[model samples]
Target chain A: MDDEVIICRCEEVTKGEILKAIEQGAKTITGIKIRTRAGMGLCQGRTCGRLIARLLAERTAQVLEEIPPATVRPPVRATKMENLVTSHGE
Target chain B: MVNKADAVVIGGGVIGNSIAYYLAKYGVDTLLIERKDLAAGTSGACDGFIFLQSKKPGFDLRLALESTRLYENLADELSYDIEYRKCGGMILIETEEQLKAIIELVDGQRKTGLDVKLMRIPQELEPILSGHIIGATHSPLDAQVNPFKVVLGFAQGAKRKGAQILTHMEVQAIRTRTVRGELKVDSVITERGEIKTNTVINAAGVHAPVIAKMVGLDLPIIPRRGQVLVTEPLPDLVTSLLVDAEYITLKLAPDHRGTDGLGLGFTLEQTASGNLLIGSTREFVGYDRRTTYHGIKAITQNVLRIAPALKEVNIIRSFAGLRPYTPDGLPILGKLRGVEGFIVAAGHEGDGIALAPITGKLIAELVVKGKPSISLDEFGLERFK
Candidate 1:
């Protein structure tokens, strides 16, 4: 069902590539993480960003706080290259 | 996969590497593609604030005071280390109707000469702001930099003055012809092929109306978005560049609300590594770069209503960017009247990174001087007809 569901657990990104990045227009969720890199791995989308914002508010009928949640950046966990060579006083 | 150029440009952010660094420093033959990479959009989700104390006095505060005097000599003319900071901004005035609409916007940016003032903010200036402010303005020519080192210092000064960036690619159309009856624009079909180039500069930010509808032109340029956050590296707490003087009348309409509807407030800055760059929220919400939970809870409940000691900082990250907007917040910039060799630099919604180097030296003096050292008929595109 929907290619074994799995919508982006650290970029496994499914639900059939978020319905093929919503048939190629995406409409948001940072346009399906720039079209399917899906919340960009390494827990960046914090576990599939509210399940791809509830599958883009149930495929656009719009609901869940009006679908909006992609655009999370930072070492939200995972950086240590000695914090990128000491950005300053660790 | 044929190529050729006299200009192609498209978009690589920081206004397509400052119009491919002044169209290869006037030698032309530039290229510059990029579908991603190079501040992958909205110049890597902004907040550098080269702010001119919130423009809007006329010709958008005289083209933001000539792009704040070209970022005070753009890091020694692009030797590149865009940490460019002059540190002096403030704004605040948290209501008495935002101190009477920020004293008529610091008296229309001090009659457009700008040295703002209005003072009385000091609690050691930023001992974590929020003394429940009643006033504040202090311009000192507002500044800050590092929009990914100003798009890698204008794509390394347009590839050491030869130009031709081409990352990831993907343009796809804008071929045009007509010849005797008029029309122009010769090539640029990209997904990685045809180049040709008669001169095509869209600077596709917020996908400039899908690259001006591949040359037929119907540009209102939408996608407004915004949203931002980042903290973790404290210690300085937030020195200069504050902003929230009702975000210049919520950037003069794009439905950027806040008559208590969470006015897309604040535009804070502070980086140079000390983090704290919270920001923005000017929805229209088309190219949704997300981060909404009411735009990051109205930017941390409006940055803890002016830093309630930043409720123990540590936001770390959040973003969203897209701001091509243009419903008269200015920025259309020349061309599109009968098309001819296409131009239009792109709508500068939130002032495209403080007007990317005077819109790449006025689109490289309108492609090596066809008239444009200033006088873009109020940035036409037939003022959106």
Candidate 2:
């Protein structure tokens, strides 16, 4: 597998970054987030959610279900400044 | 590029942005730096709760009161709409134990001159609230704001006042020097370059302790992870910031575990766009900011305890933030000994949005004028040592 393969496009996180995070004791998806910031982007982790999880699972020799997904936050999609600034604008 | 500033504030969340805004407003050459965009971390992840009712009755509540006062006209003053709302709050009492705690909580707040009512909440306030709740404590003073806008507004306002906000400029290290038998922060080394500043304010949120480490002062601030789920924008289900008594107790008391074994507390809020923002947990999982299946499941089931109609609601997103947890549950403010020109303004775990305004004003006052408008004696770093 190419280490350069992009995992989290929102943050430009790559498989190399994910692998490095895993090597640094990132046993969980949340752990990976803290280390590489893979899921802390615009889409919040929806796009790269499974790719990072599967990579973590493969490395740890654990089932995919064992590795949890990263936390998804508000404005699940790209939001305009107006929607974010004003209450009723959304 | 090399830049010199009178004060350099690290972190781009509400706290740092507020400090930058205040410092710039005070005519100080300030530089606000962030590793990510504004409100990208906990400020963006958590709900926009400018809550005062849940504050601990003494200095904490006083701080909330003062901050709320600052927020009253923040949108007008900033010339940017932050979506500030005093939509009120209702803390649900489920168990008899919760009832007693809330009674004491409200009594303490009332003694502090906060207008709060302890009774069966009228159906007009929140008809969707579960009938199973024994009672609720309602406070009109409770308010909220768009955390993102608050950060953005402060950033733009601060920029307009000539504060340089450098996003993606990560602080690599803290450069310090000894002059006249005193250790002082000489300059802040960042990924971009060096920022020579006499004063450095650590408003770095959950990453605060890591910043404190550079100065050799061990702050006992730990990052406590909290998760929240966002439901599709629905009709006005609840008008108030609805939370549980267990949530309040767990947040106020660190030693106490969940009233229920699941360790999940319900916080339901209806955003201006009509989305049901439900949250959260106080898991001590270090700096891992990911949403877990168990965490989401717990929040969903618990919120259902308050509003059964939510069982069918589709969750659009799930996210988490790392709360800057201190041992005593109080935020660390003011300067530390041995590190002159290094001020500590972080450790606001869950109440960062609520306390940002006051923190900014007090810290800025302490920096520029050498005396804060309010006494910060109790919140100083000496108590932690």
Estimate, for each residue in A16-62, the C-alpha lDDT of model 1 and write its tens digit: 87877665435567657654657644466777888778777777667
Alpha-carbon DockQ of candidate 1: 0.07
What's candidate 2's DockQ score?
A: 0.07
Query: Per-residue CA lDDT of candidate 2, range B29-63, in tens?
Result: 99988886567788878898888887899899999
Q: Candidate 2: list runs displaced more than 4 Å.
A: A1-90, B259-262
DockQ-derived CAPRI band for the predicted complex in model 1: incorrect
Give the TM-scores of the predictions, in the order they appear: 0.39, 0.82
Model 2 over residues A1-90: C-alpha lDDT tens digits?
799999998678889989997764456676677556577655678888898889878997889987656544545564432233222322
User: Per-residue error at B217 for model 1, in Å?
Assistant: 23
Best by TM-score: 2
Q: Give the TM-score (0 to 1) of chain B in model 2.
A: 0.97
Lowest summed lDDT window (length 10), candidate 2 chain A: A81-90
Query: lDDT of model 1 at residue B214?
Result: 81
